[model samples]
Target: MKRFLGFIEKEFYHIFRDKRSLFILFGMPIAQILLFGFAITNEINNVEIAILDHSKDATTGEIINKISASKYFSINQFIEQEADIEAAFKKGKIKAVLNFENDFSKNLVKEKQATIQVITDATDPNTANTISNYINSILQNYQLDQNKDIKIVYQIVPQTRMIYNPELKSVFMFVPGVMTIILMLVSAMMTSISITREKELGTMEILLVSPLKPFQVIIGKVVPYIFLSMINAVVIILLSIFIFKMPVQGSLFLLGLESVLFIITSLTLGILISTISATQQTAMMISLMGLMLPVILLSGFIFPISSMPAPLQIISHFIPAKWFIIILKGIMLKGVGISLLWKETLILLAMTLFFIGLSIKKYKIRLE
Candidate 1:
């Protein structure tokens, strides 16, 4: 019994002394609980929406006021005409647009009913559905409150039009997110584990001492993985189109180019991980824990970023997967070209450059 107690005490001391073990035991749970609690939410707050009021009447004004008063929505803009709605959605700022039909108040009073067309950008079908439901609820509550004393009960009908995805297919949303995750995790894990394996087996020192330069070494290490990742991407896209009937509304050439760029960005990030990590296990752990979680939770893949807390939303901007997912959705669903997608494309390019520079610097330090 005494020897067994000594062994248990030694195990406790070993766990406490290792910083990584301490973090895995205590820090990870705390961080995961906080991230899951805040990020995994169905309710949306301060979602940006626009209004197109043709009536310009008291009834429309009151309804707009009521919508603006709620914390669920923030009136981003008041659109002028019907043609502007498409442009607004392509710009990727407005989620839903409330278009009040002409002669709203007069029709309500004369015909005892009125119709409000709810046009939603349904690239993210869940959010579109939720926005439509919230608006309908508001209209119902308003109708009930106004008709309490009247003999003829007034009705406000919401005709919801889900553009881009009328059927609200879950596959439309999942494909882009899954593709982003696969590219990021696979590319990163492949390169990170490859380089770290060389280090673990003592072959990296042989390569370092060779005539090849560090940049050349890095490029050679990543080139094979880059080709493999592109093939994986093409296979995924083909499967999505052929098996699932997913449409590629935009240019395929442009999609291929953007995918190559994201793959490079992910590979460069992996190289950075390899430089800092001493073993394949550490690199794999970092790739899974550091990259996978952010890609799933913070990339607006599973949940709306506008619905997350302010800090998480801000942190999401740094995530490359977030921008790639946006780009994929824009091309696949909206048929948006390079003009509308330039900003996100540029962001991914900049991240690629930043990661490349940092990885090279780290590699040079390790060489020294």
Candidate 2:
């Protein structure tokens, strides 16, 4: 018991003595939350749109007025010629261009309708779609107001309810993913590098020749990291719950259990990495470049899998971080139970077992 406490105290010194890493470990979650909350949002507000009104009549003027009055569109430019529209977009000034057809009032009175073209830059598709929808909503509202006195035979009203995120807040999607990535980095990457450091320093040989079993040595090394990562997870959850006002609708106990499972899975990966890497530098590099990038890009963390190419989407299935993040979101945001997240939980367990099995095999080979 004394020896274990001393070992834990040594681990604490190793962790706290490093000022830079300590700062990163504690500071990163707060920084990431702020960045994702304020900066990287999907919601569009006051998007700049240009107007190209070929018609100078009442109908076109009214439509333009309605668009300009709405909060979504800020009409920065009124292009006289069609040529200017391309130049404005080339300069990256405007996202959309609303063009009213020639003789809009005449067509509306004579033909009972006027044509308006919405030209959007598809380079950033989400923003483009939002701008287009905003314009459509303004027009539809104006039409409804104008036709309130007249009777229509049938009206098709489309009702929408956002299932996962009612407010369409990207933070709701990001908090779980960010939490997963942070835990993975701190537990897996840091532990891997630290273990490799022991090997590089000739300390592993001394530990191996000691009375402690190989598995026990590895467990002792990783146990402190597991506790640290649990602290990180708790801190992140508290920030998300209190600061962001995000809810954990599912069982808190279940969330903690799943988190521990994921931490163990990540620790197994760290062990595998340590077994493969001969040096601390190599371990760190492998963890950052190989694990972190794939976890971020392919894990459906920032971008939706549905939006990716078929090949990348297929590749994402193998990333354990992907499954863990999905489970976190299911439990945290959607308040889903074990019934919904069982598949992801099973996949994580399988990954953990696979990594541990591979590491054991590799370690035995090294021993022989």
Candidate 3:
């Protein structure tokens, strides 16, 4: 027991001794959490837009006032001619241009509807779509206000609602995926690199020849990473809760347990990778190319897996992060219990077992 504890201490020393590794382990999680939480978000804010009001009427002025007053947009400039619209967009600061048709108030009084041309820069499709939606919403609100004093013959009001994320904050969508990625980076990438570094430094053979068994050696190497990764997990959760005001509606205990399961799964994957790779560079490449890409692209982190092509959807099932992401969003967003997440939990467990078995088999063969 003393010897095993000493080996664990030695591994800790190896980790803390390397400045680059320390930074990657600690600094990356904070930087990534801050970046994803604060900077990378889908919510639009104070978009600069140019307006062209051909009518120059009271109603058009009111609509413009409402639009400019709303937090979503700031009127950059009101242009005189239509030709200037293209130049404004070409300059690249403005996201949208709102053009009211001539005699907008007269048309509304005569036909009960007025035309408004919303020209948006399609450079960023999402941003453009959001800008258009905001404009439409503001117009709809103004129209409702106009009709509030008058009686309507037949009104069919469609009440659209959003559950879970009512405000649709992108942070809610990204937190789970970011947590998964951080765990993957620490568990799989770090462990694989640590093990490979040992082999490269000629220290792994010394341990292999020591009184300690191979299983003990592997466990010793991975245990420190598991603790460090969990610390990272805690930090991420705390940041989401306090800074972002993100609620963990489900069982915090379940979240932690599932996190541990994923951590173990990631650690086993690193072990499997290390067994196959003889050099640190090879392990790092495999972790980034093979693991990172699949986790980021295929895991339904940024893109919905269901929306993917049939072939890619089929391939995504093999990616562990997909299941983990579902588990995360379920627990964090929906507040779901284990009863709801049994399948994903079981899948992660099975993957963990498979990787551990394969790694052990390969390591034994290498020993022979």
Candidate 3 shows a clash count of 0
lDDT of 1 by residue, 161-249 (tens): 99988999989999999999999988999899999999999999898789997568778988998899899899999999999888999
Deviation in Å, model 1, residue 110 alpha carbon = 0.3
Tens digits of lDDT, candidate 3, 1-368: 99999999999998898765665578656644643444334556678888888999998888889988987788999999999876676444576788787888887777666788887754334455566777778877877788888874222121222335556577887888899999998899999999999988989989988999877998899999999999999999999999998889889999999999999999999999898877797789778766886787678677544334456667788888988988887777667788778999999999999999999899889878
TM-score per candidate, chains pooled = 0.95, 0.60, 0.60
C-alpha positional error of residue 194 in candidate 1 after TM-score superposition, expressed in Å = 0.7
lDDT of 1: 0.92
Ranking by lDDT: 1, 3, 2
Instruction: Go through the candidates in order and give the clash count of each.
Output: 0, 0, 0
Best by TM-score: 1
Summing lDDT over every window of 10 consecutive residues in candidate 2, give the lowest-scoring window. 153-162
Better of 1 and 3 by TM-score: 1
Candidate 3 Cα lDDT to native = 0.79
* Candidate 3 clash pair list: none
